[model samples]
Target: MTLTFASPDQPAIALHVIDQDARDGWLEAQPPQVQAWVAANGFTGALGQVLLIPGADGAPDRALAGYGTTDRRARVRFPLAAAAEALPEGTYAIASGLPADRAEIEALGWLLTGYAFDRYATQSAAKARLVAPDGVNAARVEIMANAEALIRDLVNTPAADMGPDQLQAAAEALAGEFGAQFEVTRGDALLERNFPMIHAVGRAAEQAPRLIEMTWGTSGPKLTLVGKGVCFDTGGLDLKPAAAMGLMKKDMGGAANVLGLARMIMALDLPLQLRVLIPAVENAVAGNAFRPGDILTSRKGLTVEINNTDAEGRLVLADALALADEGAPDLVISMATLTGAARVAVGADLAPFYTDDDAAAQALSQAAFQAADPVWRMPFHTPYETLIEPGIADLDNAPAGGFAGSITAALFLRRFVENSRYMHFDIYSWQKAKEPGRSKGGLGQGPRALLTALPGMLDL
Candidate 1:
């Protein structure tokens, strides 16, 4: 769905945001007739409660949105979105009572509520539209909403239509739209280019595996994003059960989110050199599929023993991260739906990240709150480094015992990026259930927080 704020000069109904604590006082301040109307409708300002007060002409003159209590608001990321969804089809502007600090997030949430993935089946869009509130950056919020839509579209598409080739097309299209440079090293060329791990993990699929790269910006600190693009993972020779494979279409969520972040960076014209690397592949089972207990050499020349073929996301990311580290970018961040341990650790709503840079961590933590995107910082946990070190190879793709699974995965990816300041995100990129602004489908994690944190992290 296309999301845009109403024209600044357009006629709009006033929307008063009311919290439960101030409900009675707000009622006292209104005209007696309006107060009586609200009372008759039982408008107590409970969370998500919306009431419309009519004028003498029998038309809606103003609207009331319940901000509810702090505890009630704490349960969801975008509390105001509940009202946005419930409002009638008309342009509405916030007249008063919204906290200044919350205005931007609430406005963003309202825009996000417009999203609906109706690619295969018909889906209805939200009817209510919002005007950018005073003091909020409408352009930035719109950019974020559009980027988020791109991510959702890419992730929601099935693997048949979103394989390596299609993923390259999407990246190329994005680059074309922004005048960025785009290139892809596909099929056997990956082997010729020393990306053996990426090739090994994807050789069995009909669609050739590829390393998709895009570059933009000419000056300032360099930032490289490496995203795991396992388009669809059948777990290769170490196959997953039917239940586990059901959501394999979302395996490429990391790539989708990276593209979304790139869109925001380019559209906002951030003063930084940006490079994106995505290893797009489908881990399908076939006679040629890479198997367990097989040792493979990565682009960085580190040998990895495949203890579990299902652990392919980290394998592809390792090669891409090594390539990014070769450039020695100021910062290299790799995102992947790599481990189930992460989902179990923090649940689905919070993006779990690992970073050794305390300043970067601090910036991201603060930005997450401002962006209303939640994140939890996991550790590199140097002591657990030995867990990924198997006797036969430089590292074990899947460390036995399943203990510290997420940490071990991060430590494995870290081995290839020694020169750059690095961070890793083990994300569960699916929203298992619908919330206010977030739909129950493929989700974008960490990108919004990263966008807010970049200026501080890069000293821009």
Candidate 2:
């Protein structure tokens, strides 16, 4: 990973992180020359503002970063990352003014600023380097940063390069790296293995459909993560318009996110038996494509009527969730870029999740703020459960009327898991515009929050 810390013994410049409220007091403590330089530069501690001070030799001796006011800070995330981008190439150490409680998050933000997807095109690497701040877990920060990079890299790739086979390969590689047991059920084997919905949705694609599974950690609580791996969504026979099809390459973002979360879990050696399931497929159009009005039997024996083939993500995830539930893991969480309704409800910045478990919801909500990964707890409204049930079938893949689309989708997936505590994240997984630390490209949502919340949820 490109995101890393400078060597501890290296000579470094001091980075004075000044907030707007404390700017004047800080300036009074400085020498006359330093005070004069600060006034001349118009450094009032606005958010993201950076100014360099010269030494006796006339070279840059130290740097100042603005942390802005409380009101301004509440409006943005990764505030330090903005300053990290503007700083010149050098190793810097935090000198003063950083809040102790926010040290870990700010330190992580600095590392994230170094991420750039340079696989297909040559991209400039971040110039500024940081010394891991005191009291921050340097190894944990590194693991989170590397895992976020993995998610970004996978989602940014085009469908041509990130198809089912490629996704499977990525999972296999991850499993091998952590010495996890990896197994895959591919092509006709899915049919033999009773993943009929997975086979149905992917039958039209050139690449065969498959289920990718990885298991790690033999002790402690059992946790299973199911991610939707629709590599590309042409919307099937209910074809998406060109405008909507532009970013279909990120349809597998759910799978990318779970893999990233798994990386963090295994790297930290969390005391839990972790299982990951991804039903990899490409929803391409052809004669055999699962068409509208088609009724298919899922692994759980629930017959689902396809009202719109565009709603194919839930089909694959249903089969995977059913398989995960069969193991009766202590917790089963499904992450998917499944519904546009979720995006409309909370926009791109927040991950909206549905869960029946109040304890899980509370833990995730609290942890999300601490991790700086925003999440909203959406309910698995029991009253609307009937919306997914059409008279002709056990469930409707795409409910009619669309009053509560995201909720209905969550309810549909919830049907397959009868025994385990379940949670579902409906994530957009794309950053429409650039922000501090988060570039304008494929994005990862909810993973970091889940990482932080796991210990409390499982009592680890």
- The TM-score of predicted model 2 comes to 0.99
Clashing pairs in 1: none
The 0-to-1 C-alpha lDDT of every candidate, in the order given, reads 0.93, 0.93
TM-score against native, each model? 0.99, 0.99
lDDT of 2 by residue, 178-198 (tens): 999999999999999999999
Q: Can you write out model 1's per-residue Cα lDDT over 336-398, one digit (the tens) per residue?
A: 888999988998889999999999999999999999988999999999988998989999999
Segments of candidate 1 deviating more than 4 angstroms? none
What is the Cα-based TM-score of model 1?
0.99
